[model samples]
Structure formats: C-alpha cells, structure tokens
Target: MSAEIAEQPAAARRTLERLMPQRESLRELAQGRRRVLLAARGSSDNAAIYGRYLLEVVAEVPTALAAPSVATHYQANLDLSDTVVVSVSQSGSTAEIVQTQQWARACGAATVAITNVDGSPLAQSADVALVTQAGPEVAVPATKTYLTQMVALGVLADALSSGEALAGDLDQVPDAVSRLLQVDVAAAAEALAVADQVVVSGRGLLLGTALETALKMEETCLRPVRGYSYADLRHGPISVVSEGLLAVLVAAAHGPLAEPMADLVRDLHARGARVLGIGGTPTFAELCDLHLPGPDLSEAVEPIASIVPAQLMIEQMARRLGLDPDNPRGLSKVTQTEFAG
Candidate 1:
C-alpha cells in the first residue's frame, strides 16, 4: 500500500467520529414509523443495497434501493410517505443522485445523505447529512470510500431501528476495518489468476455484495465473472463447474441461508470447481482456500469488511494480467453525460 492508503484509516476514523449523523436525527426517523428509500448510482447504489438489507433486517423497517433515475424519471413509483430518503454518493455532487434527493425532499420525505464530501450540494440539501470519513478518493475506482459509506449507512440503519445502543458500536468500526485490510488477500488472487471462469455467490445482504464483487472483478480483473444467489447458483450456473472453474462464496455473519450456501460450496467442489470462501470462519473443502476475518458484523455490514480482501485480490489479479489497476482501459474517474446543455 502507498502512503496515501496507509493513512486512510486514521482519516476515516476522524470522519466517522466528527461527521456522522447525530443519533437524535436517526432516532427521530425510526421512532416516527417511517420506511427508508435509498437512492444512489454505481458503487454508491451497490452500497445502498447492503444498507437497505440492514435497515430491513436489523431495524425491522421496510426499505428499498432505487436507481436514482427511477425517482428522477419514473416518478410514479416514488413513495415519500413516512419515508426517509438516503442519497449516497462519494462526491455528493453526482447529478442523478443529487436530483433524486431533491425530488424526494419535494415529495415530503425526510432526506439524509451519506457522502465523502462534507458540504457538497447533496449534503447541504439533505435534512441530515452523514459524512463518510474516507477523505479524498484518488483512485478512479472507489475502494475505501465505498467501505466507509457502508459503515456510515449501517450505523444509520442501526440507529433507525435499535437506537443509540446499536449505533454506539460504530465507534469500533475503524479499528475493525484497519485490521481487515491486514489479511493476506494474495491467496485469493493466486487462486483467481489461474481460473478460466469465476462465479461469486452469496445470500441476503451479502447477495448485493456478491453482485458488487462480481462487478469489481469484471472492472478490475477484466474477467468473465457473475454474481448469483446461493440457491440460484445450483440451477444453471453450476453447468460450467469444472477443474478450471472457480466459485467464490460470500458467507456473511447472520442469515437464514448459511447452511444451504455451505452445501452449494461442497457441491461445487465435488464437481471439480475450485471453491474460495470469503467470510467469517469459512469452512472450505480440502481442495479450497479461504480468506476470512474481520469484526463480527451483520450480514448487511460484512460486505464492507470483505471489500479490503476483494480489492487486494483484484490488485494482484490485475498485476498478474499485466494491467495497471491504477488505470483501466476505457474508464475515467468522473464521467459526464454527453450533451448536458
């Protein structure tokens, strides 16, 4: 890691402490019997998927993750009734998500923003702004910022459902995140390099994480990767299972699908596919390797912890493929739509 990333945890810790949404704000939203609607795009959208899961399961509230355009363009489906709209963005200036937040507020929803930028427009527009302490995201592809977004979102969910008791635990997350990055993800990378095809599978909250992981692999490793639900993986995705195939599983902290997921891993291994488990206390088969460890967070929050290993794996995979992760082809840090006049 460079000096830049080496100090990310400290900066993130400060941001988490200083700029998180006030507990009172979140408690008020939860106490009011409101649902949550998460609006975002790209990786921020993916983070909202996990956040939605946390809100539903932990907070015991109804939640949804909507594409920003869905609210901005498809207004008919938008619901503002007793709803808390959370707009997540790294820049807090993305045109689509920011516009969606405006629409939500105009429609009478309590608006919150989780962003890296402190006083950017989206944050300023929100009724409650939660700043992720990720500092500046220099990489064209998001890494730490996405992780901290989840941290901020997850805490907000806890506060929304369980109150200060649950939200207070967020203070320990920076230390946990720092320790997670210390794991050697090289093993997973080594396994990925030789494989011809890869499938990433998960359930519940981690299912969205599985999708994000697949997208990252596609973006960084330039490989054919797909995300699937644990049960769904057994249907048609297993047809490709073979000696050269790799199946990566994201088994999260707590969920009803854990045992079935374990069965899928075992079945995949039996069919000659290499299995790699990424979760807490993975039980990989004799032929498989596991990359596991991090704080015991809910399944919704495990993806945040898992992102460190995922990035390391991709970094090494990109290096092996003779591609610079710092600069991927046909991609740029910021993208503006054509003819925006």
Candidate 2:
C-alpha cells in the first residue's frame, strides 16, 4: 500500500496523459446525455461520489449513483436513454457493476467504464472505456487505483465541459502528491490511535474524500468510522460527538464550503470531540486540535491530492495498532460476488 501510494504522482501523470487523447470520445459520449448515473461498489463507489460532484457542478449535469442490485436482482428497468451511465471498477469484473453497464447499454444510454483492466467485461461492455492506467494493485486496500480514478474523473469533467483549467491543475497533481507523501504523519497517527470511534465530515467534492478516509480507517485500523457531509452531520450525527470521539474535517482552502467546515471544527472542539482538520488554510490549521495541511490546489483537483496524507495516517495508525495494512483480516484484494457469474 505504501509503495503504491508513493507511486501515485507517476501513476496520475500516466493516467492523465492516456486520457488526454480520449477527450473527443468523452465529449461524444456526454454529448446529448442530459443526466449521469454512476454504478460502482467499495472504493470505486467513493470515486463515483466524487464523479457525481464533478459532473454536476462542473458540467451542469444532474448525476445519480446507481444501486446495482436494483437492476441486477430486482430487475427494475430504468429509462436511461438520455443519461450517461458510467461504471467504475478496479478489476472491471465485479458482477453487479458489469451487469449494470450491460443493462445501461441495453437501455440506449451511452455507457463508459473506468477500470484498470482494458479487457475486463465491464470495459468491453461500455461504449467508451477510460482506463486509470495505475498498473496492478496487489494490496487489499486500494491506494493508487483510487487516486488515479479521481484523476480520470477529472479528465472526464474537462472533456464534458470542454475546459482546460482543470486539466492544467491536474498536471501539477503528481508533484503535489509526491510532496504530500514525504510529510511525516506520525503525530496525527498517534492522536487517532486511541479513538474508539471516528467521524469524518466534509462538504461538496471533499465529501468523497471523507468517505474514503473513513473506509480506510475502518478496514485497516478496525475502528468504527462514520462519514457525512457537514450539513448532514449537524442534522443528527452531531449529538454523537463527545469526549474520546475523533472527528476529522476536510476543508478546501478557497471555497464557499471552507467556512462551514471550519465552523464545524470549532463546534466539535467545543463539544469536547478531538478535531483533526485537513486543508490548505491557516485558519483551519489553527482551529483544529490537530491539522494535516494538504497541497495548495483548486478544490476540483484537491480531492486527489488531499487523500494522500490521510492514507499515510491510516498506514501509521494500522502499524501502531499492530495490524498489517497490506492484508486486512477478512478482506480480499478483489471481491468477486455471485452476480459476476
């Protein structure tokens, strides 16, 4: 996992370069598509969450995350003729994901598969395939593949919107991620080592980062971690915040959502919850009990860069807890379900 995380900058560069030539295809696939639906599971589902925000906010398209069982098991037919349905899978063989892609194509929607394997069933079923090009990931926890998937989503966003601004920001991501991997997260790891439960919160695009971070902690550290957007947190989850609870807040430095995240940090601190802030702002750093500063970048591209330190902290916490992050108990690198067959 550590090696793969370290390889992210290079992997991101390769993924962006590979997707650049596919811009025309991406544009065509999204041409007349009025809405976007994403089908994925596990870590890829987290990537889809980011994709939802990107496509909706940047491309001005409505997006929905698909429940694969609805199509695969319930056999519910969807009117996706005017929608672009995207399947995101690492191996591209997850049965339900593949089934969803096939179902979408049959419904007259343009299907796009974002996967590492070019020859996988999901890739073959899609009208367009956007490969992450992260090479082979052997760790039970996805590091590089998850990061590269976000990069591919960024490229797709640019292609759909016909904008070069995000692409320019993405070009700098590799070096920024490389710099983040070098930062020592031992102190932050130690701070979270004794937590009985964790709550991760963010807003907008960074909510996906929060979700992935919580999953990483749960899988590797064997802790119960719940993630929510800042607004959702206040709805009911805020009542759970108290002493001995660990709260991780992700904030973008220069965005409308940044202030609310900072305010949430202060609120959590007042409630006696230990707050750890991850962002590129001085105010966020000062407000949290502990802070991990990320690379200065646009919020659109920050999701790929912000996740690095959180992954590092999870690795450190796993070691501190005497667990092997490479092979977490009761988990496999590639999960094949009954639907795949």
Candidate 3:
C-alpha cells in the first residue's frame, strides 16, 4: 500500500491532465442542462454529494445525488430529458451503478462515466468517460482515488459552469497534493495517541471529507468519532468537547463561510477543544498540533489537500492500534448486497 501511494502522484497527474483538453467538450455537453443526476455508493457516493454541490453552486446548475437503487427500483418515473447522469465508480463495474446507468440511458438521458478504469464497463457504456488517474488502490477503503475523483469532478463542474480557461489553472493541483502529503504526521499521531474522541467538521465540499475522516478513525483507529459542519458544531456538537477530545476542522478558502469557519476554530480553542484546522492558511499553526500545507484552490477543489492528512492520520493511528490496514476487522476486500447461484 505504501508503494502504491508512493507511485500515485505521477500516474494521477498523467490521468488528470489528459482530460484537461477535453474540458471544453464536456462543458459544452453540460451547459444549460436542466438537471444533473449523480449515482454511486460508499466513498464514491460521498464524492458525488460534493459533485452535486459544486455543480449547483459553481456551475449554477441544478443537481441531485441518488443511490443507484433509487432510480433502478424506487423511482422509475424519473424525468430523463435535458438531464445528464454522471456515474462515479472506482471499479467502473459496480453491478448496481452499472445497472442504474443502463436504466438512465434507456430512459433517454445522456450518461457520463467518471471512473479510475478507462476500458472498464462504465467507460464503454457512457456517452463520455472522465477517468481519474488515482492508480491502483490495494486497500479496500478508498484514499487517493477518492481525492482524485473529487478533483476531476470539481474541475468538471467549473468547466461546465464557466469555460476551458478554468481547467488550465487546474494543472497545479498535483503539486498541491504533493505538498499536502508531506505534512508532518509525527505531531498528529502523537496528539491522536492520547485523544479519546475526535470531532471532524467542514463546510460545503469538505463536509463529506469530515464524514470520511470520521469513518477512517472509527474503522481503523477504533476511535470514537463524529462529524458536522463548522457552523453546526457550535449548536450542540461542541458540548461534548473535553481535554481528552480532538477537534479537526476543514476551513475552505473560497467559500462564503470560510472566515466564519476560521473564527469558529478560534472559538473552539477558547472553549478548550484542541482544534486542528485542516484547510486554507491557518492562523494558529503553533496552537495546532498538526498543520498541513495546501494551495488556495476553490472550496470544491480543497478536498485533494484536506483528504491526504486525514488518510495519514488514520494510517498512523491504525499502526498505533496494532491493526493491519490491508484487512481491517477480518473484512474481505469486496462485499456484495446479493448473490445469484
């Protein structure tokens, strides 16, 4: 897994940059679409939530996220016209999502496939394929692939909303990711070693990352976890904070809520929650046990940098707990919802 993550930067850049030239074509296909429907499961589904938000806020387009089962069984009468279905699948061959894509296409909607595999069933099936360059993911729970998917989809949303010029600026993302991967994990691990519970929070696209981080901590580190928005934390979530708990916040750089979110971090510090602010130029580096470096990309684009630190934190915490990340809790590499003999 270490070797896999090590080799990913080069491959990720190659795969992502290859799609830059085609941004105009994709944007052209997406322009003025009445509704964009995204479908997936697991971490891919979480990424799709952010994709829907980015499309709506950045592109000024209406979008919704649906589990494949919703369109396949629950709501068969879904409107198909002027709708583009973007299916995100790491394998590009998930039975349920593939089945859903087929259903959407049959209903006359244009389909776009976003995946890690180029020649996989999803790419072969869609009207256009947007491939992520995350390389091979040996671990069952996605890490880098999830980050790349967010990057590809966020840039796609920008292109679809504005123009090709926006995508050219996107080539700098790999460099930002590289910097983030170099963040000091030693400090973060030491902090986590003593923490009893961890609170993860973010706004907009980063919100899903907070959830993903919470899941990683629960599954790998055996840590108590909860996730919420930066603003929502003040409502009631912060009441549980103590000297033994860690508060991790993802503050976006380009979002309207960015500053207030930072202010919330400061407030958390005053209230005694040890806050580790993940995004943007953090004001209190010495106060934060761990400070990750990042580029000031759009709010939708901040996930790439924010996710790596969470991955490192989980990996280190797992090692501390004496658990093998490759196979957690005797869980198999793959699981199914149904099987046919």
For model 2, the stretches where C-alpha displacement exceeds 4 angstroms are 162-164, 337-341
The residue-by-residue lDDT of candidate 2 on 267-310, one tens digit each, is 88889898888884787888888889887788788888999999
Please give the CA lDDT of all the candidate structures.
0.73, 0.87, 0.73
Clashes of each: 0, 1, 0
User: lDDT at 153 for candidate 2?
Assistant: 87
| Winning candidate number (lDDT) | 2
Off by over 4 Å in 3: 231-236, 284-290, 296-300, 330-341
Worst 10 residues of 1 by lDDT: 280-289
| Residue-by-residue lDDT tens digits, candidate 3, 203-253 | 776777777777667766666688787668778877877676788776666
Residue 35 miss distance in model 1 (angstroms): 0.4
Model 3 clash pairs are none
* Model 2 RMSD vs true structure: 1.5
Instruction: Check candidate 2 and list the clashing pairs.
Output: 95-340
Give the range where candidate 2 is weakest over 10 consecutive residues by summed lDDT: 332-341
Could you tell which candidate, 2 or 3, scores higher by lDDT? Answer: 2
* TM-score ranking, best first: 2, 1, 3
Stretches > 4 Å off in candidate 1:
1-8, 19-21, 29-33, 77-79, 253-255, 282-287, 290-300, 336-341
Which candidate tops TM-score?
Answer: 2
